[model samples]
Target: MAFNGKFELESQENFEELMKSLGLSDEVIEKYKDQGKIIEIAQNGNTFQARYNYGSKVITNDLPFGQESEFVSFTGHRVKALAKLEGENKLVITMEGLTAAMELSGDKMIETLTNGVSTVKKIWKRI
Candidate 1:
């Protein structure tokens, strides 16, 4: 899939539950509860870069496909993630204990995050 555009958050499912499962504090949860994020994905060959805003912070992750990359998680933990393309339209990223499966269909991007037990679905629309 060619993920080279900007996407705005359309909807998110089980957000609070997913945050709780990730061991986020109540205070932290309440702080960013209603805040939505906009993400920009830029891909060139096997190199990938994704930029997103978290609160007042702008986080960017740059990595290569099929390689291990370290990034700071939202919960303030350092974690490793391996990103790869699955088929023609799916982008899969495997993190510590979680997997993010992203698919681009038309002008919408659907991302499903699974942490073994709990799963959260987030949808973003092209901007």
Candidate 2:
């Protein structure tokens, strides 16, 4: 359970561009701009449960490695996703046109989300 911890967002890059590319409106993006994000992850074997707290919203997903599962997107849409572990520290998920990769290093977790047009990278520190 290397990813079992609560992590707080430390920094982000190109977040606004990624939101725009995902079809989110300016108003919606602005509302969440300065909000703090906390991610809680629990891993048991090849299955993982993750909870994302974004100020006013919370999203939880159950991911089973190497299997297709349903996960809610940031845009509030349910999508079919497949998740897999890369080596021992990285979890990569593919859904629709987006790819999300979460990697752990020391007490920090780096999350990269890409949708071809834009990419957002967020660094989270375990708390």
Scored by CA lDDT, what does every candidate get?
Answer: 0.83, 0.88
Q: Candidate 1 versus the native: TM-score?
A: 0.91
* TM-score of each predicted structure versus truth: 0.91, 0.91
- Evaluate residue 12 in candidate 1 and report its C-alpha lDDT on the 0 to 100 scale: 90
**Worst 10 contiguous positions by lDDT, candidate 1:** 70-79
Candidate 2 segments exceeding 4 Å error: none
lDDT of 2 at 118: 96
Model 1 clash pairs? Answer: none
lDDT of 2 by residue, 76-116 (tens): 68999999989889989999888999999999999999999
What lDDT is reached at residue 48 by model 2?
83
The per-residue C-alpha lDDT of model 2 at residue 88 equals 83
Runs in model 1 deviating more than 4 A are none
